[model samples]
Target chain A: MTLQDYLPCLYALLACAGFAVMFEIKKPMFILLASATGMVSWLVFLLLHDIGSEVARYFLATMVAALFAETFARLMKAPATIFLVIGIVPLVPGGGLYYAMDALIGGNYALFAERGLDTAAFAAAIAAGVSVVTSIVRMAMTGRMNRRERETKKEE
Target chain B: MRAKQVERCLNFCCETGRQLIKNGAEIYRVEEAAKRMLSAFGYSDAEVFAIPSCIIINIHDGERNFTKNVRILRTGSNFDRLDSLNALSRKVAAKELSIEAAEAELHEIMGRKGYPAWISYLGYGFAAFFFTLFWGGHALDAAIAFFCGLLVKAAMGQMVRLKANVFFIHICASMLLVTVPVLLTALGVHIIHTDKIVIGAIMLLVPGIAITNVMRDVIIGDFITAVSKLAEVLIIALAIAIGIAIPFGILRALTGVM
Candidate 1:
């Protein structure tokens, strides 16, 4: 990762760590977790995918975030949602949403659609990355969740 | 998948939300603690809501219901701003000290100027601008995106009525609200302002909040609530995206990007 890419990752890590503190993270646990997320994310960008493309880089980084969240949640015995919430920040389709709105406000339909599509894709990726990983993990743990929730509901 | 989490509390227990300030109890901690106290007293069966500003309780008996404002008070803690202010607020709310007495002490704490919370908001807002600036969008556009996040949270204050965890509310509201704007923006109806204003303001809405809660809960080993809150936040964001996109698409087809 060039200094530029590394810089964003650094910011993302700091943001994640800041979140840990802001939300009252316990001592020292979040340091290693967030570091792992940043390290893994960079590795994914560098080795797993083509960083030549901006969108691709973002997509991979976000996926790595999801993976990090899933792994952390599993290891720590917490919900993966923390990773979802924090990781989604840097990758949030903020630009897509904003540019899309700008295009709309400016009465530029094509620009709006293009940006809007980009936003939806990112949003979905976030949702899917979180929901899919957590569910898969949980499914592995409690194979009885689906049928159990239903039977439990019936008894209620 | 069920987004809005509502479960019966042990009683109207005030959750004294504490921040890791390394020294006295922070605002969140004090509020949470007071709520638990009120809940135990039966003045409330459920903590209606609590913030740095005010807390509302579900008056279980509905008899001794007195006031409904977020009143600040002070205490003689023999020390700094946080302690004295929190002590005063707690004592008054719990009725250990009368409002008049608390008010007298508050004079000193209120004199201190500046708040640190806005700094975090500013950080998130700037982050939004950077996130969006690369998309060939301008500064104002990013500002709108950030604030859009705030608006979503404020709006959700009325929409989803959970009170235990403000972090959960923030995440849920942000993801849900952003989904529509993002989708609509994608669809070419971006009528909002800056990514900063639109998205940054709502950074408060992002589930980054739940990270700490989830971590603490995991560390303290309260996995059930942690997982439940996490799942709810994610699902809500997904739902919000659907809420914005489907309607946006239909509207676009009918009237074009208006």
Candidate 2:
């Protein structure tokens, strides 16, 4: 809704760019696309702030990132994992996991439980989201390939 | 097929699969690429199996069956290697390259060097800086995390070069990262958010993207690979948690404030 709210998206973009570099993404164009996927995923998470649940928000954000990755892979003729790896960095609950561990060590059982469960939920949601989209894409590609083979056989 | 031809085809397919897995490609992708390359070489009776750590290929050449396996000692995300390997496999599958030429290409891809160390260090620094800010840390905290990130990467690089196990490497890297923020906070830099800095730096060690890969493996019915990868993710998490707690305990005992 405001300029301030968009700051995290920029941070996500730059952070993903840094990771892309470390991961040896040689092409500048790919680095930009992968980093933009991160920004877009964060934006989606923010846009759906008032969603049904936090897990749902994470799931949808990861789905959008997965879609972006698949599209970019097809368009650029690269592996989708390259983009997917960098794209969802903003949504991974690395902070939550750290805080959960911190809480556990501090002997705060309640905070530890809360943060730990929340972090696992976020990870699972993102995992499910990416898997669902990738499975669909894989199946669709195979189906098309099969149809083409059948058509070629008929022509022969 | 001649014995020599079968051996060459087997070597090429196995090498392709091995490189793909090493560079963090999906199990299905590696298996499919190997099979495609085999079919292109007219080995329709080939059998290829790949897991996270090994690849086995069996080929029949009318008179004999040839089998070979490659053990993957290490695996990491190297997109450049994966991209080149993927392209190489596609070319092989398209029948665009001779066996000798494709082997040469594989050799070149395998021997290709990664980005220089300084670039990776800078990448880690900027990633930590921006991640700290993303998680609501102050500008000073981010600056502190940038250097901490560089330190973590340098330390981890040395430990890796020393042939430490992944678990030990993660433990030491997280402990190393936690020490910086904890030491800073103890030095009365009350402005630094110790947790944020530690989180930002430790992000370098966390297998966040690996979670998605594990899920993809499960979706594709690679239950064994998925379980092994999930175990890896859990092990790294436990190591990091232990790493962070060790620093906190020692520092708290010494300074009574961390």
TM-score of chain B of each: 0.38, 0.96
| Model 2 agreement with the true structure over B132-237: per-residue lDDT tens digits | 9988898999999999889888988898789899899999988888888888777787878988888777778878656768988898899999999999999999
Deviating ranges (above 4 Å) for candidate 2: none
Question: lDDT per prediction?
Answer: 0.47, 0.89
Among these predictions, the greatest lDDT belongs to 2
Interface RMSD of each: 9.2, 1.2
lDDT of 1 at B127: 45
Fraction of reference contacts reproduced per prediction?
Answer: 0.08, 0.70
In model 1, what lDDT does residue A97 have?
58
lDDT of 1 at B174: 50
